[model samples]
Target: MIPKINGLGRSFAGVAAYCLHDAPTPDERSPETSERVAWTDTRNLATIRAERAARLMAATAKAAPDLKRLAGGSRGGRKLAKPVLHYSLSWARDETPDRREMSRAVDGSLEALGLDGHEALVVAHEDTRHPHVHVVANRVDPETGKAATLGNSKLRLSRWAEGYEREQGRIRCEERVKNNERRRAGQELVRTPWERPRHWARVRRERMVPGRARRARGPRDEERVDMEAWRRVEAEAWETVADGRWRSLRHLETRAREEWVELHRRQEEMRQRLDRESRTVLGRLRIWRTERSLRELAGAIRGRQDLVEGWREDLDGYHRDERAELGKAHGERAREIERGWHKFYRSRLVEAERRAWAVRETMKERQETRERERGPSIIIPIPRPRQPRGPERGGGGFER
Candidate 1:
């Protein structure tokens, strides 16, 4: 179960109206889901709304008028008096607790959080996939005439969820995901046989192609075939050429045609090589680099581990020799270097991975463009050669 606490609200009237909204149907007064006012015996929505509104008004009249002013002067905006708190206590669909149990949980949570004295509404909502309750509480205590502070409400809610899970003996969706993450993190980080070490193994071929040309009204921006950059340049070129004022199409067309031909030639060559069971130059280079990087990372990790183990042995010996502080300092230094090296390697790998992704994207776009160029088949019907009416056989007469 997870509790979603939506910080705070200023208007008590708005909070009351939200809580009093008809369940199942907003217009109907049918109370299909259970609802009740906490800290009071009121179960009716209208009565709860009226009672809460009146309590808010009375509290405001008696309480500190400078509360809003003190919490940052009003300035240009409307004075904020966020004394209403909204909370949604949700349970997983699989673990549907009964009305009594739900109420007990809510009561316990509110009391535990020190908001039991505040005026509040607890309405069970059956509309969502998961069973949950909407809590609208007046942060301004009617009896004390002071707003209730929700310090570390998130921490408190997490504690409540854990306790609830223990009591109910059911694991929540969040808990399951957390467990999976922990298990995954603890396991060895080895790539599968089919998985490539470098992220850009998929897109290495396309990034090699040069970008399209545009008319030069001024110095050209260094053209990039990067997806978004290519698109922007394409659009700008189109707009510039389409405008009647600039009448220079020859250079643009010639440059674009040459580039297109080169790109097509490269793609064709790649296809021919694949047919003959040969890898392209770029493909071979990428594979080699991927293998080298993986090997280096593995060696680095192993070396670090071995270094730490050796340091542990030395530390034990030093402690035996009564030079414990010196051993501790050396051990700390070794661990620091290990952490720093790992951090550096992690950053380098991350940068390489991002570049690989860019290459992959470029290749994907090129593949799509190629597919579009190879449009649907054209079927032309050929007229069959006239069979010699070998003598008007139908009429039983020979044709001249």
Candidate 2:
């Protein structure tokens, strides 16, 4: 359990009203648990608002008249003593503390802080995922006429939590708490505990607004950048420039033209093979009259050899013709591919430069702004007065 302590409520009446009053919208199924409330008999916001504040003031006066004296003037040790002490005791979501155990723990914790004699109200709120109780106590002791210093109160509460856990068989010890704290501080040897789901949601919310909320890790003004990822992108861009891949618009265009020529060479090779096969098929059709005749023994002997010879000759001629035809066709295709690749490569390279330039400019502006905020440097010019020239006098100063 973690205890959050605060000095709240400028006046006794203000504190009393806050403690007794129910939330504006009450939960019928899971109502708040209230205890030790003197002024307001019932947990109703309307009833508390109508007549509780004045009654609470009277109650406080009867309990601690010295506190009233302290409030009327600045005679108390504090320049302005806080009239009420407000705090909350919250447990992990898995721990379901019963009413009796919670009350005992709350009483023990309050006594440990030296507020046992004062009037207090403990209200358990069931709305949150984690079960917690809020304790509001009058800081002033009627007999002593002074408020107790709540220094190192968290340590006291921690001891109380450990005792409560042992007596109730909760098994959470001081050692475990210390280990958890060490793990949260980034100790490698200690294993981090799995946090409740609500913790992650709270973290995400804090990052979105940033600096608006307090976190256990301390203050963060903004989201931290992944410097490694940033450096990777920067290095890649510079490497491309250094390798002469995208040094200039003309250089990128030249690389694109090279790729286009290679693509055309592959297409021409495929076209030559396809044209030769078509010519061989046409030549075979003229020599072979019918499938039945080719299958006949004498017909096959007379025509098969002639058919094979004719097709071979025709395929060789087609290969030569296709080589000439493809040379012309590839020239046009290469130009088209070159134009498309040039436009694409140029746009991409320009985008990369713009992104890198933007990052550099942002960093420069931040540095300059920091220098401006630090104010100008002071350069002190020490005066070195020249020595006065005088007529030499052995025993008396010269008059000029």
lDDT by candidate, in order shown: 0.52, 0.53
**Error in Å for residue 2 of model 2:** 3.3
User: How big is the positional error of residue 352 in model 1, measured in Å on the Cα after superposition?
Assistant: 29
lDDT of 1 by residue, 1-400 (tens): 8888876766666555555554336576454333532322222223554446535543552354354455543323333367667787888777667788888878877876778876666767665678887776666554444566676676577676767777877656565345444433443223454432222311232121112222222112323224444444445444543342122222333343354445445545644543332124444334335446554344334444453344345444543454334334434543443354335434443444445456657888999999889997689999998765645557545655
Which regions of candidate 1 deviate over 4 angstroms? Answer: 22-80, 174-400
Model 2, 241-297: lDDT tens per residue? Answer: 334321332343344346545544655565565444335544334334433344433
Pairs of colliding residues, candidate 1: 203-360
**Residue 119 C-alpha lDDT in model 2:** 56
C-alpha TM-score for every candidate = 0.36, 0.35
Q: Which residue pairs in model 2 clash with each other?
A: none
> Best candidate per TM-score, number?
1
